[model samples]
Target chain A: MPPGTALDIRDLTVRYGDTTAVDGLDLQLRTGETVALLGPNGAGKSTVVNAVLGLVPSTGTVRVLGRTPAAAVRAGCVGAMLQHGGLPGESRVREVVELVRRSCPRSWPLDDLVVTAGIDGLLGRPVDALSGGQRQRVLLALALAGEPPLLLLDEPTSAMDVEGRRAFWTTMRRLADRGTTVVFATHHLEEADAVADRVVVVAGGQVVADGTAAQVKAGIAGRTVTFTADEDWRFAGLPGVTAADRQGERISLTTDNVEATLLALLAGGRRLPDLQVRGASLEEAVLSLTSRSRTPIGADR
Target chain B: MSTLFAFQLRRVGRNRQFLFFTVLLPALFTIFFTQVFGAQAGAAAQYQAYATASMVSMMAYGALGAALGATIRISFDRASGWLRQLRVTPVATSSVVAVDVLVGMLLTLPSLVVVALVGRLVNGVELPLSTWAGLVAVLWLGSGAFVALGLLVGHSLEDKAAGGAIGILGVVLAALGGLWVPVQLFPESLRALAHTLPSYWYAELGREVVAGDGPALLTVLAVAGFAAAFAVLTAVVLRRRPLHAVAG
Candidate 1:
């Protein structure tokens, strides 16, 4: 757990016109952990973040640090980086930071926060002049301006390049280590996998899967083994192994029963060599979880 | 809240376009209209009175533009997710709205000065010291009324194009109210109809002050009544359906 209870949403329902954007969705973010909210477009991820910030009207219970989102804000408990470039176009970055500082009782220095978010050089520039990634970095800086114990990031790195994103991931880890709870929402599964301590897959406006990286992957039902053998790999032909790929001396096997695969490998009739057992990546686990819940990619399952 | 109000005032000052429309442009319009109409307008005492009153009322309407620009900018804030960012800050949401209202009021002062200068110098309008005091009161009342109106429009229409529509509406109301031209010059029947408009009430307030009658205590009461009504009505609409109702 991180230092703060990042956010707690229970039975939150949001309606826009006649359509329900979020229906009875429940989520919780623990202290010192980065929880990645993964969902397709219109899956209520942003809505959940908005509800936690009290930006929109909604029905249901939401608590950030044991108080309503607005109350929590007044108490200096939470901070956020919402969608793309959430800043006034004409405002200078320093001016924007100062404005945020006025709203928050506790805040970091404008220069330090800017540097932390990798936008120190952009302080004098108008928001409209910044590149998309630079603008995002500035917005992220503003979110960190208040030194909030809990932070909500809705697609914080969506505009960043690979290197910028990697830098941001280091920043996130540092914040988490200092006990700030983080709830990050993004559509990019690989980024989520690389950075988030826990991955929560959301679909149909509900949380479909929630667990640590390895725990989530383990939930998808198989251990994969890849090896190169002097002779043909003995475990390749084992029952309960659903997939076997062989190319020259290399063999890859996916097994439904890990115990059976390991025992067969130990039998050694084909002299198994250089064997390695691998768990599924978080991306694969998320795909499998979402696929089993609905459709994998194109069609609904 | 005062801190946020100060910050918002700073933010509004950075908007060059808002300053142009609400301050510079209105002052220029007063000067230009008075120059074009001055000779014929000065011929009749009542026309001179009408011209001066119109100039004064235009000040109040310019104040309305300040409110309108602030309101629309707040709507933009909502759309850009700045409002959301504010919500998660230590500042209260009421502070955010309060800052805008306060900034609108602060910006209105310079605009009123520009209109007064145009009326006295460009239109050759004169007023007693007491009349100046009354003018301030009437302008404040008119401004309060229009700020409320701006709030209602901004709350109801959150789109950028809708802001233009409301800006046009503000200008039309001012024209009908005699901010650009006196309603007295219009036909009697039309003047009678104009009297029913809120802008006319504002214009009338200025006319009475400059003409030395001053607004009777009862008339002042009536202006207060109008301001209160607008404020109450706008507050109700805002309470019922906030601009970012869909955001959550």
Candidate 2:
């Protein structure tokens, strides 16, 4: 409820018939903060976001800035880029932006936002004619039309390619820098790692972990070490190393203690080539945590 | 509600495709049907009544389609996550549905006028002052019913295709309800089936009014009741399903 906190969700739960889509999830975002919600498919990340927007019903409490989602929307406190391209077919990119601007009492200039979102070249194109990445940009432009204090995005870059995704991340960071509180939900851990100042990993309708990206990585408690050796590395007896394998010249090790393993390897007089120790990439962290907690997304890896 | 209403109306108006389907197509059909049936005297008389009634029904039916179109819009929006984006925005959640209904109404008005005019000019149908008033009343009642029906259809269908299927069915109901020909011409069993339909009730009321007869007050009551019932049914369904994706 404090000023600049675009969203405050507490113990939120949402159910559809017998299925509980979101269970006791808590989330918060303040101005200039870019928060990423990371989870595999079926995680309640989207449910929580929808509940905060008032598009879906939820039990518990959700306040946007000091008001409920509906109230906040009327007060111009939130902006969103949902899965559906906010731009309708038959509508030009410029027209959609202008329309949203009209709905918003305080609106940004269409030309300026068009350029900022890198949609200057797409202004005259009908929404349906644009490529997926272009449509994504237009959706962002629509959401940002009012220059709302809070922004909610559900897979903002899911349809974009590598370059497009990277560009969108930069745009998102810029928005946060300009005082927009952003909460984005995505299945791609790498995207979350690249853009999210804070990451919340949701699974089985619950917040399994919530903190900075480093904290989430640390919570998983393992590092990946890949090195090349003459033969397969005998990692069966290594302490703190949970798993290890060799692929051709590459030796991969999963260890709970990276420093200790490195020291032990060095002491063994084993001259390893191309040895690299990584605490955990967002992808590794999510997979390990989800695998330990629930159904192993054996496929995601 | 006002701002949301205004915003939705404008947004829908900008959808050239939906606007064409909701208004332009129906008016063109009204003109075409009136011309096609202009020759036969009895058929002309029947057509006149049918055209008037169908025009009203068409508004309700098309309004229903447009309303469901909003559902399609929502489903697609959510599918890719646009609805989620809007949720974080300052737009009121209720505005989504509110705007859809208002857009349906805007699209409904022009079609109603086109049908009335075509019926009078091409079909030589003239009505008394009370009949004119009754047409207005029936259009409102029928429009309300279909609007609610559209909401229910939109909320209940998981696939956008199914939502569209419901819209086409609205047009089919027109033929079965005697919107193209008098229900009197149908087989006894067919007539009985049509009589039980809300579409039939709407057409019968339009026919009665066009004959310079004031429809029984009960007719108005029944139409209004159907509208309220459908609206409640739709709201309840929507509450349960919320944003489930419709068949694309």
| Candidate 2 local distance difference test against the native | 0.68
Q: Estimate each model's TM-score.
A: 0.79, 0.75
Cα misplacement distance, residue A56 of candidate 1 (Å): 3.7
Among these predicted structures, which one has the highest DockQ?
1
- List TM-scores of chain B, every candidate: 0.85, 0.77
For model 1, the local distance difference test gives 0.72
The segments of candidate 2 whose C-alpha lies over 4 angstroms from its true place after superposition are A1-6, A15-23, A27-30, A84-86, A187-190, A201-221, A224-254, A258-284, A287-301, B1-88, B133-137, B158-160, B244-248
True contacts kept of each: 0.57, 0.38
Please state the error at residue B116 of candidate 2 in Å: 3.1
lDDT of 2 by residue, A278-298 (tens): 876555555556545432222
Model 1 chain B worst lDDT run, 10 consecutive residues: B239-248
| Model 1: chain B TM-score relative to the native chain B | 0.85
**After superposition, which runs of candidate 1 have C-alpha atoms over 4 Å from their true positions?**
A1-6, A15-23, A221-301, B24-38, B41-51, B217-233, B236-248
DockQ of each: 0.32, 0.30
